[model samples]
Target: MGTSASKLNRAIMADIHRLSLNQATTERWSVKEAVEGCLRHGIPSIGLWRHKIHEAGLRESVRLVRDAGLHVSSLCRGGMFPAPTREERQQRIEDTLRAIDECAELHADSLVLVVGASSAVGLVDARKMVEEGLAAIVSHARESGVRLGLEPLHPMYAGERCVLNTIDQALDMASPYAPMEVGLILDTFHIWWDPYVLQQITRAKGRIYGFHVSDWLVPVPDLLLGRGMMGDGVIDNRTLRGAVDRSGYAGPIEVEIFNQAIWDMPGNDVLSTVVERFTSLV
Candidate 1:
């Protein structure tokens, strides 16, 4: 590229002040490295994963981000609401409470929740368990000053990963709770195919607690690890992001990807490509 074009790209990135890197996007990077990578690229915020926090001691991880000077957009997850027995269910809720404490410690903006999967008991019972689980933990989360953002995972994951597969369903379950105690996470890869997505996003105007982006590819080899970089697949990132912008969701737009190919690349190289693609395509 010419000097002029390179300068223009930099300027565009500067204007993308709300862009954030979810740690999963560069899975190989340690917490410290992810914070440094964000700093090196002029990225102002990052989303964290709990496993990384455990790997690098919790208190130390919190210190690392504070010293590196970056804002945390959200914690990767805090929900897996359904379990086979009453004892296990309570344990899961307790685990979530700890995650809420961690979020408060790190001063993260929200705690993303992948509600639960439909298990042997049947979808109906599993969903009821999810609501019960949320009811169990919502008060603790609200007291800790952490918002629970329910992420509607792709319908493909309904049977094994997440039973909550649509924005409307998540909203219905969370509607009874206070806004700060319950919210939504909108991700392009999951919701782009819904005919009512735009309408739902509009309805969720003030309820969005976090926003994420990644493309959906054809002939995907692995459902969990086949996310394409922005523009590398079929999603219309610009339109999706524009809709979020118009909906009064002025918070950071996170780049959360989980592809083996991306993880295999050098972290710095992957981060460079992420910024370039986000600037041009998202």
Candidate 2:
């Protein structure tokens, strides 16, 4: 057999350096500034939101990230799929195609999808619309060489954020079509409540293109803004990380928190805390 040193070297080579910061954690920072901060902290990657990109001119934003040598793990979002009317639905699809262009411009790894919720229709109709919209956008995404990362928001968000409330549901929507470059974005906070999380993660396998980390607060205060820092809440990051590792996923763990309190702090301080939490506690 080969020496222990040789075996160790091989294992090290295969080890995944999975770490990234989602800009939303430091929502106060400008897009360019966030990229610079992340680079300064030795973070190799980031996930960006469209609003932030629009705030900073697209070309300038792309140039800034390129200058810092940071990879965009994924464009923050794209899939608000449901609308009350046909015109609105078509418009969302058009907008997502535009978002795909932006992702390509940024050389992002994927375009995260938060499939929209039902507007005036029932949940079932809303889900169907999400599937239809994704099918429409997948072609454009392929042409642009951008991957789609379908994110299943928690059940609480099913009424307003996403109709696809589970990993299996998101996977089912993407599996049949299987765009040449499309995949899913697994978020621990949203999926942790599911008893079948491990099974779904295994089912995802190679299709998991991104992973987001955040903790869920007990007695959740606000549906949208009460996210906890990784170790500050109930979710078990270690177990989730192990499952992803076993599933053969080697991607950045994008930290996406929408806490009102965190957002109130200084941008630099928030970034610092996130980095510290990720290393020491998460």
Candidate 3:
């Protein structure tokens, strides 16, 4: 068999117990509904957002997920580190520490971090602030036994969403942090456009704690919300997955998309499509 074929076989036989769905894919679904949907689809894992947990009530959400025997790949987000003042930055850290507590409650694999963007200063200073903020939260996460996964947003979102815009940058930030304590969330959509993707993936190796999948729309209308379904956009997730697998990081493949168009459809239909597309194309 050729490399792709061999990889496909390995992927098939590897007991893909870690396939997960992020609730953002079907925004119409409540947290309870999304958990039910994952169970219906035979997806064993999920990534949850703080808002959904709040809406569903934290205790109930925990009860439902535990009863269903679902694995939380990671919490959706916990970082918005770039603030205008020292007080605001400290507030963000405290909020993230709370998020860590929630992750522990949910028994999530890690807490995903979308490090916030620059203030009026610039990208360099903003990145520095993010690093400082992450360092501040590392001790708390360690104490709570929650691993931190830093997600690098695409450069397009660098101004507002995340200042950490490349896998290399994310790896650099996480290298000193220790893999058991903190790591990187490797997402194809954000890092696909990078020229150094493969090299960075190779370097990340064991430090890749979480893997999220989404495609890049050619003419991305809304940078934050116009995420395409896997196989519907330009990213070659199979190749990306190959690199990830080769790096010896066997973890959950969490699908996270934020397309308003898809969210308007029936939640089941959206989830069914994601499962179909992930199986056939990813």
**Of 1 and 2, the candidate ranking higher by TM-score:** 1
* lDDT value, candidate 2, whole model: 0.84
Listed in order, each prediction's TM-score against the native is 0.96, 0.92, 0.93
lDDT of 1 at 215: 94
Off by over 4 Å in 3: 1-16
Worst 10 residues of 1 by lDDT: 115-124
Cα lDDT of candidate 1 equals 0.89
lDDT of 3 by residue, 116-150 (tens): 98657578888889989998999989989999999
Estimate, for each residue in 113-215, the C-alpha lDDT of model 2 and write its tens digit.
Answer: 8998975887889988988898898888888999988888889888888888888888888887664466788888889999999999999898988888889
- lDDT for every model? 0.89, 0.84, 0.87
Q: Give per-residue lDDT, candidate 2, residue 220.
A: 80
lDDT (0-100) at residue 204 of candidate 1? 79
* Pairs in clash, predicted candidate 3: none
Report model 1's TM-score to 2 decimal places.
Answer: 0.96
The candidate that wins on lDDT is 1
Error of 3 at 122 (Å): 2.0
Model 2 misplaced regions, further than 4 Å? 1-17
